[model samples]
Target: MGSYIGKTPTELEMAGNEDEEDALGFKLTVLRDAMIHLRVQFLHFQSFYEKEGLENIGNDLKAMKIILMVVQNKIEELKSIIPEYLEIKNIGMVKQKIEDFDLVVTEIVLEMKEFERDNFLMEKVEKLINKLNPFDVPNLETLDQELSPNEMMKTIMSKSAKKQQDKMNKETIQNDVT
Candidate 1:
């Protein structure tokens, strides 16, 4: 993520100024596009499994299709609700819809991949679903800035510390063995 260095989300929203709505529209658009992509992918996999006569896998794909349909409905609902919520500045319903969409995506991913772990098509669907989760919305407010510079530095240091500790432990074990 690039650093917004000196701008806030409110500032960016003001900059856009076309309609005084929350900048969440971009996230919604991405979610819709991702759903379309997922639908096409599921359809393709369904066709492949059908041709291969993999009945069970085909059924799983069908379930995935159903999940997509629900997701599509939720996206539509959010589309309408977001503008109204923004105007009133009450986003409770909007937040709830997003949460619901996230839950359905989670269910689809699990249903498609968990039981039939080895089904290659299902595995692909699961990964795609995870990648496209709407709740994983990028914060445009921070798009102009690194979202977590401090957290990132801490993670890097922690990883290095862990690596050194593991190496020391391994050396000690080797000495004992010798």
Candidate 2:
């Protein structure tokens, strides 16, 4: 993964000049990215274990599922706080929302840390935990800064297309060899 270069929500909050909404938006975006990354990592690890015929990964997979659900729920909660129309319903609630968001994120981090410590899939889990760490939010922020939402969507679609093309090319090569 490329190094991320941008301000974290904590840094933005500490700076005290950034708009509260923007800071919260940045945080939500980071959390969304983290959730996506975590889900992808979990799926990768699960598939690896299954392919290796590792039967002991069931418990770990369950734990990962729970974590993903929690993250998805939190992301939904954060999204609901900011209205779709961009009109601030309760300006006073922004600070409270930030604090609440931070608390949930801290809880999730602790859970991930404990899971990482106890799980057999240590290396992969550790990577996921590190990515989800609050201090590492800047890594995601860099990507956000580099791409607008539409551009990011397009990039993702293009990458998916490229991967599919590569898979077809590999299949063709294998068939030729056969």
Candidate 3:
């Protein structure tokens, strides 16, 4: 495994000016780290509960852990998409595609947040959490093909622009010849 000496990949990507937003980012990182530590503690607690024959509670904890893992994986997947997106020179051409991607990702993040905050589902999840079983939701291995910059260029770019540019070039060449 490659060892990073300083910032993690996300931190490296997120480096910014030391401004008000930067302060907020620092605070967010602190909160995030605290939440992660609490999650680890919960995992240990769940293990203890399982050993004590409190299978239902253990299962609930396992289910929660699985949800956390899925969210984290989704976050990483989205992060990986950013550089590919920024590398595109013809960003204006793929404006609609970019908007679509943003919309989908925002909805996904909102759904997950709502899932976490859902008080109505707490009772149901407690009862059915045991049935959820095995702490691995499927990874998003197959993201939308159009989410790829190369794929978007190939499939979604407006051919009209190119055709227009070609026409202009042809007219220019003919004018020069005359």
TM-score preference between candidates 1 and 3, better one: 1
Question: What TM-score does candidate 1 get on C-alpha atoms?
Answer: 0.38
Candidate 3 off by > 4 Å:
1-17, 55-178
lDDT tens readout by residue for model 2, 80-176: 6545414443322332333434544554455555654663444434443544544333222342354457644433454457558647864874575
Winner of 2 and 3 under lDDT: 2
Q: How much is 75 displaced in model 2, in angstroms?
A: 2.2
Highest-scoring model, lDDT: 1
lDDT tens string, model 1, 78-138? 6565655444332443454455456556556565655367634454454446555544443
Ranking by TM-score: 1, 2, 3
Model 2 spans > 4 angstroms off: 1-19, 84-178
Worst 10 residues of 2 by lDDT: 135-144
Q: After superposition, how far is residue 124 of candidate 2 from its true place, in Å?
A: 21
Considering only N, C-alpha and C atoms within 3 Å, which residue pairs clash in candidate 3? none
lDDT of 1 at 107: 52
lDDT of every model, 2 decimals: 0.55, 0.52, 0.42
- Comparing 1 with 2 on TM-score, the higher-scoring candidate is 1
